[model samples]
Target: MTTASSVSRGRSGWGSTAVAVLLVAVMLFPVYWMLNVSLQPGGGGAVASPWLPLHPDVSGYAKALRDQGPHLLTSLVVSLGSVVVSLVLATPAAYALAQFRLRFTDAFLLGILVSQMVPGIVVANALYGVYSDLGLLNSLPGLVLADSSTGIPFAVLVLRAFMATVPGEVVEAARVDGAGELRTFWSVVVPMSRNALVTAGLFTFLFTWSDFLFALTLTTTDDVRPVTLGLYQYIGSYVQDWSAVMATAVLASLPAVVLLLVAQKYVAAGATAGALK
Candidate 1:
């Protein structure tokens, strides 16, 4: 019986390992291909060497950073601005939702969630008409506002979940000592849900950073285009520069990678906190 159990356990372990390997391959294949193309010399005209990079160059990176200066800067500014604004606006709302049992709280939460379900293109079209009338077309603030609207819902949801884990007694104790709602949130709730805040902030940063359609449609000039839209410019009607496009993609991916690495601890902690509670 012991021998049979050991063999079955070994088979299960191997099956689990195989499943993990397959999942990893599925996720990494596109990234591997992008890197592969970025290193290819012929720029996707025809592969001189199919399997390996014959000659890798940093020229693509240089062009993406130097030649496309305004787009890169615009992406950075818009993404950062959106994330900052979303966090600032969402944090207090999330705390209130989590701590208070206000009338219509469920309805309000449902409304926020429903807003996220609305298609981006639909919102963009409506906003486009409004912005054009208001002279907000081709504006960075307009792009930031659009991104923030989507980001705030998720931020509030995640932060509220984290905030819910905080013991009510602590908040009550602070309030009993004469601390105001803002003070209690800042002093008690904010400090307790630091991990969730970081996780939500990182997510907001990633979403705004990678947004394309809204950025492209809302902004007409290089000064307000995000990196995602800039990538489309690399492709022409007749041909595309695969190497440069891939390099830009790789560079665009780096910020999200760095964000995940930096906030991985927070993500893990927040997830664990939610699970344990």
Candidate 2:
């Protein structure tokens, strides 16, 4: 009986492993195809095999980087800038919401959550008008502001939940030592919530980096246009260069992938901590 049971368990384990491998392959096929197409050398109306590149070349990457001009750089700048600005502004606000009991605090928090429900496209026309009126159209700062409006609420909510997990005793002790609110927050609360902060920043970075609608509608020139818009430009009305499009797509996805890989541990920890608390 024991031997029979062991054999059955072994077969079950093998079956599970096979299924897992198949699932992974299915998920990864699209990414493989994207890379394959990106490396292929062919223009529109050129029939190229999808599985393998007929003429593998780096011209697509070169075009994406060089001929594409400062758009990639502009995207990097806007994404990084928006994340930093949102984190800086959101952290203290979150800390306040988490730690203090202000009048209408609940209402304020609700308002922030409600703002996220408003679709970006619905407000694009109004925002464009506002940007034009303020001379902020086609401006980096304006783009940052537009992205931040969406980013700040989530940042605030996530960091606030993380901040709530911190022991109030630690904060009280800091205040007893004559530390002011800012000092206590800087030295005490900030350090304890580093994992949460990193998680929030990573989330903000990914959202701002991937944003296309806002970036396209708000900015007019290549100077402020993000890689999303730049990639869109490759697809013309009459024809589309699939290879270059795939190459740009791969390149645009790299930063978010790297950021997630690096910060995954913190993200997990922050999530677990928030849930347990």
Candidate 3:
């Protein structure tokens, strides 16, 4: 009976593994196709074979490099700046909401939720006039601030949930040691919530990096263009450059791919641990 049960369990585990593998393949099909198209010879994405790149060409990548390199750097700068701003503002606000129990905490959180519900286009339209007046249009700082709108509320929600799980006794112990609230938060709470902070920062980076709407509306000239807009411009009104477009897309996707691979463990932990209690 023991041997029979062992054999059954082994079969079940193998079956589950097969299902997981199939699911991953299904999810990765688009990425595989993008790579395939990028590697094809300059035929505007119309390759003779779909399965493999029989004639790989590097000219597309060369063109993309020449055209989109500055845009990619601009994206990196804005994304990093947005992450910094979001974390700086959200960390303290999240801690307050998690620990302070102020009378308007619920209202404040509700406001955040409402902000998320507002459409991105609406926000962009509203900010355009403000940015024009402030002379922030077509600038990196303007893009950073606009992108932070996408990150800050989500970070606050995630960080607050995780921060709430921090042991009350631990915080009390730090206070008893004569640590002021700010010092305690900086030294103890921040260290304890490192995983959540990393996870929040990762998401913030991705959000800002992938942002196209704000980049489109906020920047008027090529002086401050991001990779997303640069990629969009590859398809002109008369003709489309599919090879260069796909190459640029692949290059743009690299940061997100690398980030997920590097910080996936922290992401999973934060998602599980930050479950609303």
Best by lDDT: 3
lDDT of 1: 0.82
Candidate 1, RMSD to the unseen true structure: 2.0
Q: Point out where model 3 deviates above 4 Å.
A: 1-20, 47-50, 237-240
On the 0 to 100 scale, the lDDT of residue 158 in model 2 is 89
Q: In order, what lDDT does every prediction score?
A: 0.82, 0.83, 0.89
Per-candidate TM vs. native? 0.92, 0.92, 0.91
lDDT, candidate 3, equals 0.89
> Better model by lDDT, 1 or 2?
2
Off by over 4 Å in 2: 44-47, 53-55, 237-240
Model 3 TM-score relative to the real fold: 0.91
Query: What tens-digit string does per-residue lDDT give for candidate 2 at 1-277?
Result: 9999999999999999999999999999888888887797746432454577766887777766764558778778888888899989999999999899889889998998888888889877789999999999999998888888778898899898889888899999999999999999999999998888898888888888888988889988766788788777766621456767777878888988898899999999977777766
Q: Please, what are the lDDT tens digits per residue for candidate 3 over residues 1-277?
A: 9999999999999999999999999999888887877776665644443688777887778888988999999999999999999999999999999989799999999999999999999999999999999999999999999999999999999899999999899999999999999999999999988889889999999999989999999999999998988888765621355677778889999999999999999998887787745
TM-score of 2: 0.92
Query: Which window of 10 residues has the lowest lDDT sum in candidate 2?
Result: 42-51
